[model samples]
Target: MTPAQIIQAIEGMEPAMQRAYLEQVKTVVGAATVAEVERLIADEDEDGLVALLSLGALSVFLELARSVFIAGARFEVKAISIPRDLGRFEFDARQPAAEQWVSAKAEEIRANATIDVRAAVREVMGRRRRAVVWPAAQQVQVSATPMVRTPRQSALDLLGRVSAQTGSRSGGVIGLPGNYAQYVLNARAQLLGGNPDEMRKYLQRKRRDRRFDGIVNRAIKAGTPVAQADVDKIAGRYADRLMKTYAEMLSKAEALESFGAGRDQVYEQLIAQGLDRDSVTKTWRDRGDKKVRHTHSVMGGQEVQKDQPFQSPAGALLRYPGDTSLGAGWSERANCRCSAIYKIRRK
Candidate 1:
């Protein structure tokens, strides 16, 4: 399966598993989103609401990110030929230097997850605030104690899961590194899209949440009589919408969070097993925009344009996930679901 397919499969898991997964997230941001709405109704604390939203976003992000990494790892092994048996990655450790590189790179990416997740969390928080002019919580703190795993825990947890994935589901595809190499390419897309993915979802949900808060807060602060129905709408009606939106967003974001930080480990594994500079070629998707960004569109295929998104021997487009390789700044990242395809050439 392509990274895109893997992302879809994970997002479209059994309903029961999906519910179980979300129940975990609700313990953090899900509940907070509701409580903050109530707080706005009761205490008229706009800043507190914003802070809560930010914290809630952080919590959601951490959980989503962890899920993405695990899903990506699982897909990596299975993407190639399914192993005759499941347990023990088919990694060839013949090249000590390559193996070492993979291990070190994985750690490096894992460590960087905290920074990336935090930044994405803040972007969501800030975007939500801007949408409704949600005031600063005289004490806006994004980390009201993350409801889910701490960012670091989430990162480490991803690495652990990837290790488990390798042990349990890889082996047999000797000298065939397309799956491993593709995993890295796909993961970079996942990592790059994380911030925008969550931010878009937050922006949509909070736009409505805060809008409701504004209406109720206005009536309450003005000593205006809020209709009983209005009160109910504020607390219950929109809460349902918030959750529905959240579920949708979770699916979308996780698809993007399908992951990051584990690219190093994946790359090294591929290299140790014989992947090389020419092993993975990064290709662009031609959206066929009459006016497309030079970065991705310049490549010029019916599916890709010409002369953009520089490609290096290392892999597909020189640009990784977070870079503005798309050119319209971060907005391009949000809309560009374009993927990195990995093809292997062997003598």
Candidate 2:
């Protein structure tokens, strides 16, 4: 029979016969595809329990929920100020002790910072998973037994699976999704050793000022040779500033990663529930501010299939903002305020 004729013939069958025929089709297409087809068929059956289900409504609800979650889920890292007395050392540029002291202080800062950021990211991720998954589960209507409350351990295990790293750059660490954990770690390392150009410029300008000169002269006159105490004081001040800057950068990056991960998790669950990947589309939305990168600003409103990546003006391809999977560099991913909006097409 022709394809249309076969569909008509199947429709004419009694419900029991239709199910039996579905089983036969299942043997051919495999369980997953057949499951999806059954869901679509149920969606179209006006008298079927699935007719009461609304995937479109669920999509809308999830979209709104994710948007709100992304907007509100800002993880702030507290500024870590190195104590002045934390690593006091005698002034000697040639001494290894000076280097050791600096190294120790940086290690302490990194350890403390990592702990704070990780805890905050995990907490946000927990909330995000719940916000996306549970609601979708409740909305899904199936002929099988009603969805049971997943045991806490089971839920965590599932999340662990979902959060597994897909490749070198994608997935891993629940809320700090993708290469975000590594990104933050790298940033912290850089913050300690790399002299930021902005900081260098600020220091240069400060050194040219008369007030800075006076401070150095006073330190020398106070029996502190070569103004070692003054040097430490200046270093401490800038260290605090840089730490604050790093904290802000980390908070913003985590928010973006968490948002992307949460969105991906929700759609993944829907796909598992038989939603067709082809029926979904994701759109890029730039925050529409001067702070947005020029390349991303031009990408605003770009739409593509859910499985495809969006190409930025600079030729960076990303599954979503802050996505490093496609080789998007720090310039493209850092402090990105862009958002992904998903749409689902229902028959």
Candidate 3:
């Protein structure tokens, strides 16, 4: 469909459709951003595409951290100042009334799970190549070495890359504003390693820490007659503690915002570089049977029921799953397989 036509389809949908339909449109936008930049910039121009797409690695890390608190967790964004050459991010977060908030949002958390790395990205690109108008008529593909890494490893590597990229002088090709880029980098990095990040591991340990195992081992070592009921009681308390601890580490918005801010640096640069602002349209491309994720059943069910239209962010791209383009969305926005299709027609 033409870019304008796809947008029309998007605007006509109900709010839920508008919100849930635009899945991985960000990834597609990222791909389109790179392609459009290559079209305008010379091959001799230093390649800054890697910096553009690498933000996905940060996105994955933040989402995973937030998921730890998905089930009724709460957090508040607090403003803070830190030195540059660290990363770009200024807002800090605190959860003052977390214990109270968890009681209310349990349903929302249980229903929404962690977004998938591949699927989250696939939706951005959608499944099919969108036929778009360019200076030269042709199809385009974005080759981003999908940034997947072990949790600790990803945290360290992403922080290093972000610091290095943000630390560089601003006037260069991948233009991050000099004064604020470092702040944004540090803010995003801090979210990945926030109290919640560490708390997530601790909460899990509350349920399965080796202390319980040690109880069993010690009983046998001491030649103490350990009753099966007593062992079961100890294990049960671990489960109780795990749940209690999870409730205590309420998730907040700081990390998701930081990740998106990092993404925004690249997207804004590409738009300025020369991708047609009007030509790019948002359309909801269904994940189809091949890409449907079981976790996103609530959202996926709707996409499967009918043809979902795409909703463009106008110029603003979606940062993460819960982020919406307009006044629309669904309970199952997380891990949605649908993509937000963007087409660039040079006018």
- lDDT of each residue in 1-347, candidate 2, tens digit only: 12233222222322332233223222222212323423433343322212221111222222332342232221110111212332432222223432343344335333443453344334323332342111222233322232222333222211222212331111112222223333332222222222233223333433133345455444323422223233333433333233334434543443354345444444544455456778778888876779889999999999999889999888999887766557776688666767776677664
| 2 against 3, candidate with superior TM-score | 2
Q: Tens digit of lDDT per residue, candidate 3, span 269-318? A: 33444434453433334445654444332232222111123233333223
Ranked by TM-score, the better of candidates 1 and 3 is 1
The CA lDDT of each predicted structure is 0.36, 0.41, 0.29
Question: Total clashing residue pairs per candidate?
Answer: 20, 0, 21
- Please tell me which model should have the higher lDDT, number 1 or number 3: 1
Q: Give the TM-score of each candidate.
A: 0.40, 0.40, 0.23
RMSD of 2: 31.8
- Model 1 lDDT-worst window of ten: 168-177
List the candidates ranked by TM-score, beginning with the highest.
2, 1, 3
**lDDT, ranked from best to worst:** 2, 1, 3
Clash count, candidate 3: 21
Candidate 2 is scored at a TM of: 0.40
